[model samples]
Each structure stands twice: as structure tokens, then as C-alpha cells.
Target: MMYAAGLAGVAVTMLLILIRVLLGPTVYDRILGINLFGTKTVLVIALLAFLGGRTDYLDLALTYALINFIGTVAVLKFMQYGDLGWAGDVEDDSDV
Candidate 1:
């Protein structure tokens, strides 16, 4: 019962985040919402796996986590630099 409740809560939160992704005023807000939604999806998958007593779901969840991380980083990088090339040397102003 607890797992079910937790899953439900995560689902609701993901749905709310989806709404934010749709209604967000800025690209950054949408990107943040997508990142949050991906995190919640990982939680939901893990909860469902526990509730179902299936260990295989964990593998899927792990794969999803990796993909989500890569996707978020790629999107954020593209948003920041308009490209994915790592050849450009970024000067850190913090060092100044």
C-alpha cells in the first residue's frame, strides 16, 4: 500500500511537471521541468519494480537514468553554447 501511494504521488508530481513544461514562459523553465520529470520517472520505475517484485525493472531504471543524464546535459550544453563541440576552450571567469 505504501508503495502504491508513493507511486501515485510521484505520478502526480510528474504530471504537474509536465504541465509546467507546457506552460513554462522560458526555455530554461521547460528544460528544468523536463529534467525534473525524468527524475520522477526514475523514481516511479523503481517504486513500481519494488511493488511488482520484479528485479528486471531496476535494470531498465538504471538505463533510463543514464539516458536521462546524458539527455539533460546535451540539452543544457546546446542551450548554453548553441552547439555540442567540446573543442572550444571556455575561459572561466571565476579564475579571474
Candidate 2:
């Protein structure tokens, strides 16, 4: 029915995002693709839960979204600072 068609569309979108992730020209582009893929995954899980009449799956989807957000932030931070634990203090290069 309509739900099945919606699922198919989402699947196609996810496939496209995967291609972007694989063929992205830059690291940031790949990272953006990954973030988008995660978002689509969340949507897919939510739709599946609705299709199955399972409320618990909605909770699972929310948890996955939280993890995705945290993971994306950690990765971007690591990419920018070269360390996940970097403090926000600017290094004094004048002593060199």
C-alpha cells in the first residue's frame, strides 16, 4: 500500500546517500553524507515501527538518533582538532 511505497522511496534515498558517501570528493562531504544517511536510517526505523504497530520501536529509533548525533559531533570535532579530547584553549605558538 502507501506505506510500502513510502518505504521504497526512503530506501532509494538511502541508497543515493550511500553513493554520495562513497564518491564524495572531500572528507567533509563524506561526513555530511554519513550524517544524512544516519538521519534517513532514523526515518526508516520510525516508518517501520508505524507499519508494525510497535511503539517500542519508536523508542529505539529515538535512541539511535541520539547516538547518531553524538557520533557525528565527535567525528567532526576530531576532524577539526585532531583530538576528541581537545580543550578549547588556543595554543601559544609565540614561544616556538
Judged by TM-score, which candidate is best? 1
Per residue, candidate 1 scores C-alpha lDDT tens digits across 1-96 of 999999999999999999999999899999999999988989999999999999699988898888988888888889878999864566665654
Q: Which regions of candidate 1 deviate over 4 angstroms?
A: 93-96
Off by over 4 Å in 2: 90-96
Quote each prediction's TM-score. Answer: 0.88, 0.87
lDDT of every model, 2 decimals: 0.90, 0.88
Q: What is the lDDT of residue 24 in candidate 2?
A: 86
Assess the local accuracy of residue 71 in candidate 2 as a C-alpha lDDT between 0 and 100.
79
The Cα RMSD of model 2 versus the native structure comes to 4.9
Q: For model 2, how does the per-residue alpha-carbon lDDT over 1-96 read when each residue is reduced to its tens digit?
A: 666778899999999999989998898989999999988888899889888889689998898889999878998899878998887567766655
Task: State the number of backbone clashes in model 2.
Answer: 0
